[model samples]
Target: MAIIRPARPSDAEELSTVEHAAYANYVDHAGVRPEPMTEDFSPLIGDERVWVAEHEGAVMGLLVLTTRPDHLLLDSIAVSPDAQGMGIGRRLLEFVEEHARAHGLGEVRLYTDEAMTSNIDYYLRRGFVETRRAVDQGRRRVFFTKHLG
Candidate 1:
């Protein structure tokens, strides 16, 4: 099992590698690379908004979350292609909800490129409902939110 925890600055490079692999398959589908693939993780790590799943000292997945006044925003989530089928992405999504509850937030919201159909289905199956769809940053995005008790 992988352990989830705050990401350290030293994990930046490894995090980028994981991000790249995780989104590589979506390049052709999205017609552009996923944003996280070229993002710099050190800043997020320093601000403590990033978390990592570690298995045997290797970063298997990462999550970036932002707390809003009424809900938590799941900025991004990715699991290394090498670590697929290990449930890391699911665990990270679960952590987003747990974090929201712990912070007394009522919901968790996230958006994905509309081209990522698999992600839309994944979130829908996990109880997230589509809130809307529109163009953002020149890409069509589908937004979803899950309300908590």
Candidate 2:
């Protein structure tokens, strides 16, 4: 069974590990680590808006939603490689969408590499539409938005 709930500080290390593994390729390709792939979760998980998906007593995935009154930012979403393809990512995303709506946010924003065609397709299938593209620190990224309102 899998359960989604607010992330606790105790889960920080595991979340950080998962974040690193999930974004390692992107980080290397981009020549920089995205904020989400940082070494510590203190800045994010400590913010009180992040959530995790626990399966069989271990956290398999996580989603961090940062709000700015009018919009929601999917600052990060990651699933353990061992747990990928099991729908953990999808569940975490759904949780984010629901949480955004509950907070009265009109939309959710996120970004992924333009080079990651698979990721783009996955987001599109999940209702996120590309809004724009930009080069951030030498990395080509596509911004996406999913309306929650």
Candidate 3:
């Protein structure tokens, strides 16, 4: 079972590990330098909006969402590589949707590198539509948004 709750400062190290492991393959596949994982969670750990997933007492996933006046930005979403295919990501996504609805946000937005086709497809499958694209740091990233009911 997995429980999603507010992140704690104690989760930083493990969260960093999970973040790097999850994105490393994308880095290799894209042949581009991947952004470093959360080097320090001090800035994020304190945010009430950040959440982490724990399964059997282990940190399996984490997501940070920033609420804006008009929208909610999905700042980060990472699941341990080993936990990737088991619905953890979907669970987190659902949680974010609930969060947005509760906060009266109209939409949720996120961006992923163009080379990460699988991620793009996953988001599409989950009801997000590609609304824009951009070249950031020399790499193309597609922005996706999902309207909250």
Candidate 4:
């Protein structure tokens, strides 16, 4: 069973480790570091924007969310490489939608590298629609949004 909870200060290091391991596969394809690979989780942890998916007390995945006045941003979601193919990513995304609904937000938004076609398809299949495309930090990004009624 996996438990999803708010990230604590002590989980910072482990979160970083998970992030790096999860994103390592994308670095080569992207030809640059993925934003999540370089994000510092310390401040995010303090802000309670980070959540971890733990299995038997071991962190297996994580989701970072930012709440705005009108919607929730799914800033990042990563499942440890060792834990991939086990539906952790899907669970984390579901959690994000639930969290957004609970907060009275009607939508969720996220962005991913344009090169990650698999990820784009994953989100599209889950009901997210591409909102636009733009370049950020020299990387082409595909933005997506899901409206919740």
**What residue runs in model 1 are displaced by over 4 Å at the alpha carbon?**
none
| lDDT for each residue of candidate 2 in 21-137, tens digit (9 for 90 to 100) | 877777666666766776467666677867889999998888887888778898778988889888899888888888888888879899987866778899999999999999886
Task: Determine which window of 10 residues in candidate 3 has minimal summed lDDT.
Answer: 33-42
87-137 per-residue lDDT for model 4 (tens digits): 888899899999999999999999999988889999999999999999988
- Output the TM-score of candidate 3: 0.93
Steric clash pairs (candidate 2) = none
Determine the backbone clash count of candidate 4: 0
Q: State each candidate's clash count.
A: 0, 0, 0, 0
Q: Which stretches of candidate 4 lie over 4 Å from their true place?
A: none
lDDT of model 1 at position 60: 99
* Lowest lDDT block of 10, candidate 2: 30-39
Prediction RMSDs, each to the true structure: 0.8, 1.9, 1.4, 0.8
lDDT tens per residue, model 1, 1-149: 88899999999999998899899999987889987787889899989999999988899999999998999999999999888899888888888888999999989999999999999999999999999999999889999999997
Candidate 2 residues lying further than 4 Å off, grouped into runs, are 27-35
Q: What are the TM-scores, per candidate, against the unseen true structure?
A: 0.97, 0.88, 0.93, 0.97
User: Poorest 10 consecutive residues of model 4 by lDDT?
Assistant: 24-33
Stronger candidate by lDDT (1 vs 4): 4
How do these models rank on lDDT, best leading? 4, 1, 3, 2
Better of 1 and 3 by TM-score: 1
